[model samples]
Target: MKEFNNKELEIVKYIKEYLPFREKHIISTRELSIEIAEKYNIDTEKTSIAALCHDLGKRYKDDEMRKIIFDNDNIEYPKHITGALLHARVSSIIAEKEFNITDKEILNAIESHTVGHANMSMLEKIIYAADYLEPTRKLETAERIREKIFIDFDKAFLEVVLESITFVLSKNQYLSDKTIELYNSLVVN
Candidate 1:
């Protein structure tokens, strides 16, 4: 196993520390992410970093996510998103500026996973799809989506986006305009 940089190493430590059941599984989440990357023939390092850092923005307590979006270069992130929706955008921004994540695929996959984009790259589709269908995820829709992920990634992505929108609507929450637009574009294209 290749050793990680200080920061990457810290990330590994944090995942092991924070995520539940990581130790019980034969493959660490980081290793599983890399394996998923390899299976899809994507860049292993980029996927590894993106997968590890996907939840970085969830560190926020007491509107910290809102504060970062506010402080960023006039990015104008809407305050409507609460709960898990906030992490996707914040992690993308943080990774781009702070963690030196230059791969557009990695950044975009992180940004859009919570509400996927239209016409995503294969790598983006893989990460978004993998995160949703990963064995640990236990949402009501997990089994339904897993088949699409294995049988058809594009269809799986569409289903993921639609499902997210449906879930948000169920909770009476606002769906990001980006999400709506992406959904429409995907349906149209």
Candidate 2:
């Protein structure tokens, strides 16, 4: 059992009560992110904090997400996104405004963990990878990522992003422009 900061503890309590179904996912992400950060010589505290709160917005309904996104003028909400992806933006807002998170890197990690960006910080990479590789998530792509995670962070991240894109396409689901931008940024030379 990790001792969370006051704010982290609050977020944890909220998650436990609101998203009991995903309690394991949150903890798994936090632990895996901390491990990845330590392995890559990044800050463990920041990684842990970011991972712990990454999915905070998942507790909200679609209507609540719309309000949160509308209120956070700073966040550029996509023209359209599935209710599932909207949680990432809402989580980032709550992480800072409600949880008193002041670290830009940690906030960025939380924001970009879902759809990675052009030039992600090391902490961002760790959080994004850990979110996908968390133990609660049992995808074949996750196993492949685990095999390469300790070996190459960039490669593993790219694989996860590609896998996500492929999954979205296979389902004939709505794809965010950010995902395409991320893919171009990472893969297009």
Candidate 3:
């Protein structure tokens, strides 16, 4: 097991408390996130913390998530925000309010992990890719993206966002405008 500082340990403990069943997934995400961060010369500690807390709001009910989203004036709810997408925003809020995570990059990564934004920072891109390509996913597409990450990160990110959009559409879920913006931004640039 990797050693965590006091704050990281506390976040891990909170994750265990709130999302006990997702421990393996969280660990895998943290490890992959750290690897990507190290490769890109980003902050591994921040990546680790964001990955650990990325799903913190998953345990909340849809109504609870809505309440949190509406109550926090700082959160700007997307036009087509649905229950599936609410967790990302709520997780960022929890990370900020409950965990005292004040870093904008970390918070944005957590918020955009599920549905990416128009212009993602390297940190956000890493978390989004790591969350989807974590070892436990067992999807061949994930493996392909994982392989692509080292060779061409932007291409990998574009593929991940495309995959996410396809998945949501296949499920007949409400696709957020932000995701479309992300796709357009990547393809247009």
Candidate 4:
């Protein structure tokens, strides 16, 4: 378990209340966030908060998460994106409305952790890396990325994005336009 400031503790309490079953995973992300933030000299508090709240929407049933997307007029829930990914958008919303997180970086990190986005900030990249490299993730590639993270953040991030796209293709699932857009922007730019 990682130590949290009083403010971060509030966020943790909120997460625990919403995601009791996912405590182990959530804590793992938080600890990873702290490690990444410290290595990068970024704000660990914000990174931890973003990581803690990243999967809050996963607590909802698939149908419920879809309802959240359906109910939001601003979000265009394409049929291509799965319910598992939809939780990122919903979790960002919950982080703001339910947890009163005003930081856009934290919100964007939470929203973009699943599919990622173009032109990610340092904080966003840290949370994304932490989410992907958390200790519980058994993927051998995760260890590779973890090793490369300190040496070269962007390269590792690009690899993570590519791997996720590959996984989706392997499953014969539709890839979101946002994911494609992110890949193109990163690779071409």
Candidate 5:
């Protein structure tokens, strides 16, 4: 792993971050975070910070996530899958406003961790895919999904989108346009 800048070092308190990410995934955070840094040849510190805070917004209740998105963006969220879809953006805003986290790399990774984007940075892709495929995930095809994180990220994203589609279809829920676009785009990719 690469060395950390002082600013980067300050961002991750090390001990606190180690458990939240590790505990949730059932993979020791230090081990998993280091694996990402080593596999991607990135600074472990930055990876540590990004992995640590990737799900900060998920800590907000579904209602709170909606409230944050609603108040910050002037867009009222209807009841649906939007809270999870929108949390990435809302969390990035909080990272900046509340946490004093302004590193665009970190913020973007946090914001785009849900609903994979068209042109993701390596860090963004890593965080997004890691959060989804983390070992603790127990979705039907989770192991299959984990296999595609690097081998074919597009497929992994397609699976994520497709799962969301199936879920909405099952419940007769309204689908977000972004979800529709993503689903169609992945179908062609």
Candidate 6:
């Protein structure tokens, strides 16, 4: 078991109690997030906290997630947002309201992990790449992106965003406008 601070321990306990099924994925994400953060000289504490809470709302049903989104006045979600994309925003809210996270970067990372936006900070990139390229993902592209991260951070971020768009297109799902903006920002200008 990795050593965690009091707050992290509380978050771990919460996840174990409420979302035991997602524990493995969350740990994988946290470990990878720490690795990436260290490589880039980013704040590991914020990275770990964001990683641990990134999927905090994953287990919520769509209806429950919608209700939560509707209830939060600060959240401005697109009307078409649904499924997994909804979790990211909800998780950010939970992190703020439940865990008292005041860091804007951490909250942004959690919210943008699922569908990235333009001009993301290093912390956001670390969380986003770690979430997708964590070992448990079992995607060949993810492994390639994981390796690319150490060599060329910006390229890896771009690749991951493109890959995410490709995956969503493959699934015929509704792609978030944030993702498209990220791709354009990286490739266009």
lDDT of each: 0.68, 0.83, 0.88, 0.82, 0.63, 0.90
CA-only RMSD, every prediction: 3.7, 2.1, 2.0, 1.9, 4.5, 1.7
Writing each residue's lDDT as its tens digit, candidate 6 over 1-189 gives: 447999999999989988899999999999998988988899999999999999999879877888898899546556677858889988998999999998999999999999888898999989998998999979999998899898899999888888888889999989877888888889987
Instruction: Give model 5's clash tally.
Output: 0
What C-alpha lDDT, on a 0 to 100 scale, does residue 141 get in candidate 4?
92
What ranges in model 4 sit over 4 Å off? 72-76
Residues 1-189, model 1: lDDT tens digits: 445767677666655765434432212334545655675677887777777677667656538777787787555555566747777778788777766778887888788777776667776666676666566656768667765565665677788777777878998988777788778877785
Query: Cα lDDT of model 1 overall?
Result: 0.68
> Residue 17 of candidate 2: its Cα lDDT?
84
lDDT of 2 by residue, 1-189 (tens): 457887778988888888888899999999888878878899888988899888988888877898788877645555467567888878888888887898999889898887777777889888888888887788776987876888987778888888888988999988777778878877767
In candidate 5, what residue range of length 10 has the lowest lDDT sum? 22-31
Q: Which numbered prediction scores highest in lDDT against the true structure? A: 6
Cα deviation in Å at residue 104, candidate 6?
A: 1.0
Per-residue lDDT for 65-122 in model 3, tens only?
Answer: 8889889955655556765789998999999999899999899999999888888899
Worst-scoring 10-residue span by lDDT in model 6? 74-83
- TM-score of each predicted structure versus truth: 0.77, 0.90, 0.93, 0.90, 0.66, 0.94
Better of 4 and 5 by lDDT: 4
- Candidate 2 vs candidate 3, TM-score winner: 3
The residue ranges of model 3 lying beyond 4 angstroms of the native Cα positions read 74-80
State the displacement of the C-alpha of residue 123, model 2, in Å, after optimal TM-score superposition.
1.2
lDDT of 5 by residue, 134-188 (tens): 6666666656776665466566756755765687779887766655665665566
TM-score of 1: 0.77
Ten-residue stretch with the least lDDT total in model 2? 74-83
lDDT of 6: 0.90
Model 1: lowest-lDDT 10 consecutive positions = 20-29
Q: State residue 78's C-alpha deviation in candidate 6, in Å.
A: 6.9
Model 6: per-residue Cα lDDT at residue 74: 47
